[model samples]
Target: MAGERVSLDDALSNVDVLDDLPLSDQQPMVEAQSCSVVYTANFDTNFEDRNAYVTGIAKYMEEAATHAELNKLLEEGEQHAVMLYTWRCCSRAIPQPKSNEQPNRVEIYEKTVKVLSEEVKKLTKFMKFQHKAIEVFCNQVKRLCHQEKRKDFVSEAYLLTLGKFINMFAVLDELKNMKSSVKNDYSTYRRAAQFLKVLSDTQSLQESQNLSMFLATQNKVRDSLKEKLQTIGAHEELLCEVVNISVHMFENKMYLTPKEKQMLVKVMGFGLFLIDSDGCNINKLDQKKKIRIDKIDKIFKNLEVVPLFGDMQIAPFNYIKRSKNFDAKLWPLCSASTISPQASLMCHLPRIREEHIKYISDLARYSNEVITTYKETARTDAENRDISDLAQRGLMLLSDWTSVVTEVYSWKLLHPTDHHANKTCPIDAEEYERATRYNYSPDEKFGLIEVIAMIKGLQVLMARMEIVFLDSIRKNIYQELQDFVQLTLRDPLRKAVKNKKELLRSILVSVRETSADWIKGYEPSEDPALKGKKDPDQGGFEIKVRRRNVGSEELELSLYVPPGPSSTQLYMVRTMLESLISDKSGGKKTLRKEMDGQHLVLIDEFHKTSFIWSYLLNFSGRHAPCPCNFPNWHGHVRRTTCLYPNRHGHVRRTTCDVPRACTLTGTGMCDVPRTCTLTGTGMCDVPRTCTLTGMGTCDVPRTCTLTGTGMCDVPVPVP
Candidate 1:
């Protein structure tokens, strides 16, 4: 019995020594004694359902010291363990023919035996390597327990190494099942072959020589591998002891409370379980499980749990921190952790505003460049690709800018009260206005107002870009370019222009109303009865002005007066519109040419409104009233006459067609004679124009004009 292996039945009969031991000790002894039964258990049983047999054994080896030589041995041991497990898996995948069934050809049996021989040779080498590796690993574990520093022993790296050891058991178990399958298949084939008498004496001799030798070698390798795995299982208690000692060491060093130490152990155990159960590559794991592993990994790496080792306490918004020297220019590029202080955001409003302005300006310029290069021309494949890339970059930049602005806005919202005084929270518009007025002196509320307007305009542009990209799939680059110019560029510019017009009108009315008291002082003395009465002129002027101003300001400041916030906003709006329109590539001219009749009318109206605003702002009795002139679509100068109330308060309206050479006199009268040209039937033959007239009437005969008596008229045939 010296060289004989102990059978499972014989081992069971010899369990008397475990009988006197405690139940806990008896249990592991019984499991170890029944290792063969566990190894041959049905595959349906969970592999991870093992008891703490190893942990119990590892307890007694906690004080063993490791030698320097064991380090190299342990490393080589882990490598061999991995190779051995891989070979065992490969060996299991080799097909075994059924022994009870006769093969259609003798070639099948010969091939199976040949493959078995080759595998046996390879497995023998791996088994030798693994045998040495296991010895070294066990010795290392013993020495590791006696070492003072056990922190590295409990690291993820070493835990992974231990996981390879546990995997060896599963490999051996699977190999046993595979061996059983091979035996059953071969037995069936042998019986059928013998019954059929399918081989000659010489063939039978050759088959026995090759097949029997291979079977013997395979059984030897498998037995050796199983014994090696059992050796590891026998040291399971020592491994657990090492882990326990290391955890205690870590607990003291980390200053963890008893509960915290327990939590750490539990987390470490979970991580080790995952490493043991699943292979090393976490990317191949199920999504939810992978996410859990990642979170736990962060917890371990950063030690982000409560009661950290030092005096560091978690900040309220610790997820994002602001740097002391936060730069607004670099804000868009800064990491989330360095760009979130409310005070920093408030302090950098001006620079941030400038950055946004510059971005919009650049986007506009780039858009024009895109149009000039790609529009109205056929493009090669490379050109088209380039265009697409540029467009995508523009969209990406826009998205980043929008996100940064939104984040800044969110921070503002979170800390709505001003930090200086800690006042009650204000609405977004009010807060923006107050910040602007305080930070940007002289310009008052306009600085922030312009920024908000630009943000809105950019938002509109972003929306248009989205549409352009979506449509670009079905449409050519040219069509998309046209769409960009029309919707993204021109549309926002039109809105800004309209807004400026309204703002200008409001400022003019406000200034007039505020200076009404001054106007009243210049008026002649009224009779005692009419002293308390309101002036008819005042009512008319106020009514006419009120009809012109439209829309409410988003931020209404009490201190907002003429030429302050309103004028600044108007100037800003005008500047942005001009920058977009002044493309060096003649895109502005091209845009005008492609515009529809409505857009042309808007341009005309804008110019006319600008003229009226300028005239009113500089109006004085010393200067004579002159007609406002602006170029028409044909590049011809068209004059519009202005009429002022005379001393007697008389006013008149008239129609006239003055030549280009005509001029208006100091009395608000046209100095040139008006000529009418008519085709045969005497119709006016031209579109009639309207002009304001003074108190006097034209004495020239057959000329249409306004008079105090009535209106001058020339009869003509109806169309």
Candidate 2:
């Protein structure tokens, strides 16, 4: 028995332990096992009784064991023992069969052992590969962390190393879950094998005992793999340290350059993509899983990470073309040709530059500070220092800068501009002076500081105008004056004026032009005849009439007339009278009338002794009133000179009664009858008579009827 026990030990010792094999080999091994079972079950047995059948099986087994083709099975020592034990169990499990029956229990049991061995081999291979891969990843992370220099922070090697580390986290997680599944499957296989061993006969039981010991060895190997995975997982602290160091380098604004910051942002974006690929939320992760960098965490929360394809495995270094959340201004630090396919994709995302991020941040800070300073200045009624310290640090978007200008303009409009006043505006003279003292680029300095200065200076001028002019006069021209000052004067001067002296000189020039008599005495015409003319007295007191050639069939007279006498007209008449009176020599009173379709009649000279009048009239009586109300009796006429005729056939002229006031207080020389020739009432009133050479006579009575053309026309009275 002791010799038999020793022989059994030797057999168990020679049994090859299940080892790792490639996954491709597993299916073929399973198929081979199935074929072996089928061939063994179908083996011919020409015996009449159970003993003969048993004897026949023994002879077949003995011959099969010694066969040269089965030499490999003999070399598989413990495998033979397992096969023998399985055959014994199969013999007891199966009932006695008829002569024609084919027994398959032994074949099935032998196939079971082969399948179990294959599973063990696969599980072992998986565990070993995972363990080695994890160790390599951890060591590589350490090497990369050590090799990284401040200058090489944005280098491709460093960034790719970081990406590998991120990938390691996912691999480690998969390893743990795989380990659990292997353990469960092994437990089930071991339970079934133990049950079969218990039911075996004495010699078969002895042979099957080693199977339990082999399974124990497999359990020990699995346990060791588990311990190793745990050891690798414990290195999370090392990963945390690397991440923290990187974040610290990024946050070190005083030392790192803009290029480095931009690269760091890209690296963080890549890490975020890896995390998202694993179905984990950075912000909402558990404490153990969190990256633990406050700034990085904040950035992750603030910026969105949208993947082009949901299952994409690559990073976005060269793949992404645009991304608002990630800074890519200094991206492709390495050559684009050097980028590997595994690291990039052909996709687009919104992006911004690191410089732009800083600019926006600084702009937001400056805007808040300026607004606060404005509130303080308003509350304290004291001059405050300039709040433009952050303005020189970076450049901002033009749209954002325009908003600041608009805010400052609004504040100036609401509050008083005077620094000495009890209720003052946000920006005062002292603040403006200090703000302007600093040298700034065109974007910030001109866009914000100088723009605010122009607004403040213009506000002061407007306040002075408010004090000097009447409320009614200001009401008519205040809005137009503001727009004119901004567009024509303030904007041009802002570009040209450099120094305070220049600015003040420009402001003085603006004051002179804005405070002229024409601007200050401006009023909206109440006369219906001057409604459509846009600022007729804006530049000078001159009437402009444009003539266009028209077809005879569509011919119509175009007449422009003022509703009532205006200061502009009075000014023109005054200049004419002055020119006439300035000549001391007596002149002849000549009457000359031009009868062309376009030219106006001219009376060369008029003396008090004798009056001579020349009149020319052109008319076309066709078409209805124009949509612009031009043909209505009470409608306004644009760009036309007015001449009034009295009952005695003498032209009436107006004189400026108020001298330089130039108000519409002048009176006409004649007391013309206010009666319309067409309606014989006061519907359209004017005093003139015109004759169209070929068509008919058009009479302009005190109140005349409207014609197809805007001119006053009436049928000639039969004499």
Candidate 3:
């Protein structure tokens, strides 16, 4: 009654809709609403309580009221109320505690990778277990690795490391090829690794970064990486390239230390010593893994990069020398081995023999070319240049051949000089040195000064034996014999002569005379013994001088004469030899210059009595010394000199004083030297006896022994 009245604006909008229904029609609507709630207890209604908690019918209006806030507070309020009502219905009005859980992908991934690594380790070690275990483990990890990011990391780590395990085991043969199902192995690991890299690139560990989506796969993918690795058949050839490419890397100040460089010497040099080429040479072995392991062992001699194992002591040379192990195992693959006196020299050398042979042949050809170029270049002078300045180009040719010489020297070291002589064995230092001079032993020095001292002694020997231990130097002075020397020393070289033995006699470098490079300036106070000092003189040369006015330079080149097993002093002995040679050839004489000066220390085609001083010189680049074609090495030298004693404790030459020189067939005179005391046996016809004093002797006693001790305390043989 007080406010039935409406404002004019509302009255116009409602049109006082009550106007039509108000008096008569509205009477039942108003009367029913007023009486409805009077029986609420009987109606069993919770609507009022629910409405008290919920928002109004006009949600937008309520939202508008709280528009200043960012969150939709009204909607949230309604949701909370609805949740409370539902909780009350289902949970009997008991309040539930809020969960404190969050997604933990980090722990999930780490655990998966760890488990996978452990499993793969077991596989590598050949541990037997249900293959199902690995499968189940992977499945469990991937299932929980629900997040795309986690699956990628786990799969990648599993595949790559596991693949490495497979390769290693394949080498060791712990796991044979099997019939196990790999529908998941290939698809899960290999593909996961491939894809995970992409994912890691796109998204990093930062929490702000978005994770890539991951899709579960039921299909398997085939990986062919190993196939590609296997397709590389010419392994030795490729490795040679690797060596050639990496050689300068170490040589060009790139090595951090000296030991690294030293290690390379063994690695590269040893490889060349054994065979001609690098890979599938292992197929020539009992097992391919052994060669790889051997190579790995060589690499570790440098102390860089973690090694899988330690120093392996093997009787490496036995197999190469005579074991026949490799040939038996790899005969089908054409694998064979050669040996030398030095142990461990040819062990595991060339990976592929055939390939290596071809490589060496190529190197040898290049070396020959260099030798030819040197000949062409050295003869042409600038003023009288022959064929487009050949002389100007000769020095370059010489350097090239020198390299070839070094390569050939390496090969000779692998294959030592063969025995053509039947000389008596030489006495060791303990036997000979103690009796003559102070006792000494060989030892390597560590300091650079000491090392340089070693070089000095070697240089002296090189100077004395210019034609023997020749340096790889090209000069127009020795042009006549240069090409011959190179041809002898190239990779595929001729036979190694007992040059060092003869060299020792010529330079006077006996076991007793050497000490810390002292030989360079050494002058023997007492002359070296010859034939037990019976002669009191080994050999001597008369020196001569030659003065030739070459282009008005007044050049003087001296020459010296050769004295077999003589001359106590080696200092400048080479010069003495040359001085004697020039005078013998009837050259000009100079008074002031000593006749002992030598321009060249050695020469071939020497007089017959001088065969002890001659050595054929040939050179090359690869470590394969082929046989020499000696123009003067007639069959007579072999037949006649078979009884002559060489420096290596064996008889080398049978011809004495032009015995075979006069005629190709030797007069079959048995003039072999008697090394033992006479015992009235048919073994020797020469009259000799054994005694310690001054090479003197007594009649052969019934009880006397020839020992290294030079005593006759016991009988060596019954008389």
Candidate 4:
């Protein structure tokens, strides 16, 4: 007979007779009974174990075993179930009544049924928690599944959780109703509760055994969730109820892959379209339901956290392409696909476009902050005449551009109007020309387009700053180091020179001696001996040696010379004087005190020669001695003390004359030749008709024979 439904109150009132109904009326089918058996035996719902349990029960029911064998299987299975349940209840600290003999089979079955009933009821507790677990798993797969580092682990965990869910649904589908034995929804709770009312601690057994089985499954699921989180490098707090995870759960749970998220958002929009399909001003379904734009905006604003499908290397130029020329040339560095189909679909949505614009606005604001900060820092650095900090900050900005461009590419793709590329606001040609100077239109200076250009410009500008400013600083430091080294070496060099002063003076003396040796017998090109003839046209030449002269009309000659200080002695003295003067200390005065007479003579000669020849020429004229008599024309020189006008216009004493002076007087007294004597002014003694016109003796001895006519004796006899 089929069991009839009875109220829980009536069953409680008649608890003693609850098992009096026909046994066949409440027997669960083979699968349900086997599920309870396996659950009680091992608490394992793995496929192989569940299958073996069901298959064995089916074989027994199909009579594959004898009647005795079937009876033995049932007895053994009931005893095992009772033992396990009793142990579980004891472990939980639940009290149990003492039993002397083995409990009746009916009593065991009733207790087992109560345990399964509690297990089923407690499973309800995990419904909300299981749903959250599934949601969390889905988000991890969607968000982290595509990451290069996370793909393998996250995918494995995702499929694992998905398989668990599928198996759970399959088990729920195969469960049989307790009374019908044909699968139908059944209340294992009421049947177990009425049958177990006879026992004092049945509620305790129910709580311990039922809740344990339920918690076992959920704990496994939580472990799987923990594994998945770990695989994605999530923090430990993210696996728990930390603030970041809580906020993340609320805000980011809907972050699917770009394609799935795009489809989901579109489906939601379509659903709204259907709800408002009639375009009717329908009466309020509930008076409290007012459309809250703020709430809607808040929900939509949270969507900004979602990663967009803007993985393009360069922004789309579609809008500007039709109105003007545009091109995109940048290549993506990241491995994400350049084009996503769902992203293309989302690009057409008005709401998506608006969201993207808002995102672009955010990017623009952030980039402006970066630009303004960099400009200020650079300006301050320039003012302080320090570029070390400037170069560092510029490099930081350059490195930051990679992420900035990534964000800009995403937003610029979703933007509907390429206003930056095709702007025509200022119609004036001059304005357009001016705007192009900065490589952008004036209107584009603060928005997305300018922001994009600004990032690129900043990269270039920062690189140049690093090169120019840093290099200049390096050069300046190098130059300063060189100068410091030179200055540091100066004192040592001066000390070394001072230490070698004696050796240097010896070298100077040696050099002077060698120079004198070379000059001793050396003939100069301007020596008077090399001057062949002073007058080229005449057969005779005038030689003005001191005061010497020779034969008149043949070769007039007069000579005079004076011997002065030797040149070698003069050179050595001059060299010593130079060394003394060059010595910076008080060596000059000491050297002057040590001078002897020869040093004084050389110094005096040098001072006398310092005047020009014209100034001393009058000395030769005024102080020259008269000519020596002929036949005594040997060279003689007089030490002429000449009076010459000094620079002060007073007569000053001078010992110098012409470099080679003559002894002839200014009168013609020395012009005539000497007649007979070799000495000066000696005249011939004979009258006319003698070869020696004025000699005292005749050239022909006694030829005149006392004839005073000064003719030969033969000419006198002939007359």
> Candidate 3 residues 1-719, lDDT tens each?
88797788997868767566636431111011111222111111212222231221222223222221212322332332232222111111111223325244334334333323332333322222212222332343333234432212121112222222222222121112221221222223323333334225433322112111100211110012222323333423333323332333334422222222333333332222222223344334325332432442233222121111111011222222232223333321112243322222122223222333443454345345544655322222221212112321222222222222222223332333221221222233222212112211112111211222222322232223232112221222122222222221111111111222232232222212211112234433342232112222445421111211113333221122112111111111222222223322222332113212221223212211121111111111110111111112112232222232223435333222221222111222222222233333222222233432323323333232222332122223223
Q: Comparing candidate 1 with candidate 4, which one achieves the higher TM-score?
A: 1
* Reference-based TM-score of each model: 0.19, 0.19, 0.16, 0.15
Best by lDDT: 1
Candidate 1's error at 235, in angstroms?
A: 7.3
> What is the TM-score (0 to 1) of candidate 1?
0.19
Worst 10 residues of 1 by lDDT: 621-630
Where does model 4 exceed 4 Å of error? Answer: 1-388, 395-409, 412-449, 467-719
lDDT of each: 0.34, 0.30, 0.25, 0.30
Write model 2 residue lDDT over 614-682, tens digit each, in one string: 000000000001111111111122222233455555655532111111012222111122234444543
Overlapping backbone residue pairs in candidate 3 total 58
- Summed backbone clashes in each candidate are 15, 16, 58, 20
lDDT at residue 131 of model 4 (Cα atoms) = 48
Q: Quote the lDDT for 318 in model 4.
A: 18
Q: Model 4 compared with the native: what TM-score?
A: 0.15
In candidate 4, position 244 carries an lDDT of: 19
Model 1 lDDT vs. the true structure?
0.34
Off by over 4 Å in 2: 1-109, 141-159, 162-166, 175-184, 192-292, 299-719
What is the C-alpha lDDT profile of model 1 across 1-719, one tens digit per residue?
Answer: 79999989889878966776666321111011111221211211111212212221121112111222333454554453443333312222324344646564456555435444444444444445545655655555544444342322232224334433433332332343334433443443444345445444986657644544443354343344334434332233334433333354343333112222323433343223322211232222324342233333333323222211111112211211222222233222222333334223345456656766666775576466645665433233344334444444433333333323333333333333443443332333344323322222323223333433444555455434433332232123223222322222333333434445443233222322222222234322342111323335543212111101122441242122222112222222222222222221122242333434465465444423332222122222101111110011111122333232333445434443332332222222222223333222211213222222322332222333333233334322222
